[model samples]
Target: MSEPEIRLQAWETHIEEFGTQQYGLSFDTLIKAVGKGPRAAHKLARRLKKSGRAHVVRIDYGSPGPWRNSKNFDEPGAAPHGPLWMFADRQIAWGYLEFDPGEWHPKASTAAHLTAVTELRLALTGLDTDPQVWTSERLLRRRLKTESGLAGIHIHDAWFQDFADPDKVWAVEVELSRKFGDGRLTRSLSAALEAAERNDLCGVLYFVRGDGLRRAVEGAATRLAHQRNLDRLPNLEIHDLDATLARKGVR
Candidate 1:
């Protein structure tokens, strides 16, 4: 068994590595990474908090609607009902709003970002079984020469593949409300293809916020597929975010 300090250091290091990239860390995810029992983990978390090493953020989802604030919290152990443990220093700097316990909700919250954290939690769960997970934030920066100029691309929200093996990894992009034009779609498809061809990824996964967004993304995927050839399009998997949130029992 790892010593308490060692375990705590693992938590800190994990936060420094990944928590700084995405939105923040979840309580459950933090515990899993620490490899400690829940109660022990909670105690460690409290210690981290007391020591100013971490913070447990409370996320409250507003009613569902078109506005970014309308997003729902559906992941298991997600807040208003539970707490999200994040590194104190990494929270606001990583795009998550500052933790204000008195406030009902954070100043900013997005379905796509939250979904990324949830997906990351799912990835952490599978660590014991085998595959190593890497998010877009963790990916090595690669300079890809586009027709216009050299575009530096790195950091995907979450990657589904083993780090040690050469197996094709899946790059995921969570889209809640952002609109993409044809040109952007073409560039995205081209980038994915380039990444795949370079043996950096096996495919791409787009987690859209709703049915409407799904239609839009699918259209782009289809268009890109038609232009790039049938085989490349199959590599893109567009999924509905709500269903995933519900499946995870976030609500």
Candidate 2:
């Protein structure tokens, strides 16, 4: 196989070879490192997609700068559950919950989701595992401006892209909490499920605060999952904060 083909194979093998499905391999890096022609590289990508050996997802490398909010959203502890500005800002910092402006006080359980993702990453870090967690933050923002324009708009916390290969990519949106934050977990999961199905995402994962809310959110996520006829895109998974973190060894 050619060098580009080798690179593609390496990337697709990342999950089993590394830990995260996220492949930070630069396109430029490949051009210089692998003495493959442009046509060869493109062909390799096409083959990867056709073979289901890998997939692609938009990535957002958020710019670095302090967050700005007209209503002092940047103010500390503004959100009742967490910081409302987490999503408002262009960057994805450390936070469990991300505020959503679409619905009345909507929030996504990023804490549980990220905790699970990080756990999986940590567990497979040393040996042979590689499942990448990619961000389409930048692309999403640019899209906001291109589509939504200069005017302020509600931001969707973070768009997590799951790409196993060029043909097996998925987008995951997390919904957490039933009361106070966000409109309704059921509705939130529904929207995510809808979007994921439209795109190539495997499915949505709903992480509730506790098992008490599990049935409600899971039912919602599962129903949405089935309605879209997507059994894989948005796999409904509920996570309890305390227990999930403890199990993952995050203190």
Candidate 3:
């Protein structure tokens, strides 16, 4: 393929993946995905915006800023102050993307978590066994509403298949903070393990931040295993989120 065609193909993939995310992607995240320097990535983004294939929104505290005269594209030195990018509504209308443009806006508390999830997705691309399938939480929720078998099951942050093992699907959970209280964590874990055993998934992989949260998850897993008289609760795996991102040069 010609250089221009290759670049266009990359942009198409980037835009499609951006639609999968609940919230739009940050400029830094875009740069990482495109494998380009800041200035080049910004230029390409500007072209995409000009062509009406992408939408840009300035976000402050996870809310859209005033629409008028918002900095739609970021300059190279702007660093973290850049706006987020999403597929234009036309893309959805044309049936080219599954993401609902109306759901582009995210709550302030969830912005960071969503960004972390995106980072994890990008990091997976660098692995030896790259993802064969990646279904975002938004897409998974939509499926749950229509698929009878998915009802009452734990909805993971994302579901993916490793390229090396196409038949085995895995659940991904990005836990930035403690979300469950009381016995909720254990109950939730139990449900997930049971679902995995039912052939919904081959295993669950948790990318968690903080030592306390890791210990909590481990404790819950141990309790469940002991109660069930099993050596382990499925193929459960947990990793330090920050370290994993750093190793992949995604942080």
Candidate 4:
């Protein structure tokens, strides 16, 4: 087989072994994984799709713009795009919950979704072991039914945790375009933070898109800590997306 095919096979094996079907790899992540340039990666992906080896999902997130095929490659106005790619055989073999590619709603925020995708990519590329990615749907299923009244404690866009010990995890909340200091955000995060503290997980990491968002998250975390009567906020860490990607060795 060729080098790109070999890389594709390796990525497939990783996904199968790691059971990351729920959060399918993104176009950028696929490019990085295959160590290929944009044109080559896009060509490989198109080939994979033709061979029934991959599935794709493209969304506009309530916007009216052509999808970005690659960093600099744009899909034509007449043609649609696919940003999320999943290996078909591996997803089924791993017994992961399946969903149709067409089910992606255009109303959701793509910026937030992209942030989660970046976090997943960073964990996959940077960590020694494959991380367990938990979306809000997964967390909702894990909510307690009994009397803490914590049914709606979903504060994270995605949760990244070591598969070996899930409690040693990061509750990743993405602040893409929203003001992190919003009251609703603070209230929801306060509950989740309390739960994280009680569970003694690694910590909650707020992935903000800008300095202003970072400051807002930090300030909110501080206020929550004081309100909860904590000496120090050990369960909160805020980072900018560029810093995270840089640390993960992604350009």
Write down the worst ten-residue block by lDDT for model 3: 62-71
lDDT of model 2 at position 51:
45
Which candidate would rank higher by lDDT, 3 or 4? 3
Tell me the spans in candidate 2 whose CA falls farther than 4 Å from its real position. 1-132, 136-139, 143-156, 161-167, 179-183, 222-235
Q: What's the TM-score of each model vs. the native?
A: 0.55, 0.38, 0.75, 0.65
**Candidate 2 residue-wise lDDT, 33-148, digit = tens:** 23365454445444544444434222223323232332321235442322121111111111111222221111232333333343333322322232234433333444556664
lDDT, candidate 3, equals 0.66
Any idea what lDDT model 2 has? 0.39
Error of 3 at 228 (Å): 2.1
Write down the lDDT of every candidate, Cα atoms only.
0.52, 0.39, 0.66, 0.54
Question: Among all windows of ten consecutive residues in candidate 2, which has the lowest summed lDDT?
Answer: 88-97
Q: Give residue 108's error in model 3 in angstroms.
A: 1.7
Residues 39-148, candidate 1: write the lDDT tens digits. Answer: 76566666666555555554445533332221222345433433444555544343332222222222235533654555544543332322245543422222122322
Error of 3 at 170 (Å): 0.9
Candidate numbers sorted by lDDT from highest down: 3, 4, 1, 2
Q: What's model 3's lDDT at 225?
A: 85
lDDT, model 2, position 21: 22
Please write out the lDDT profile of model 4 over residues 112-150, one tens digit for every residue.
465355554455444223334444323323343233576
Q: Write model 3 residue lDDT over 155-226, tens digit each, in one string.
A: 777787866887888888888777576888788777666656664688888888999999988888898888
Best by lDDT: 3
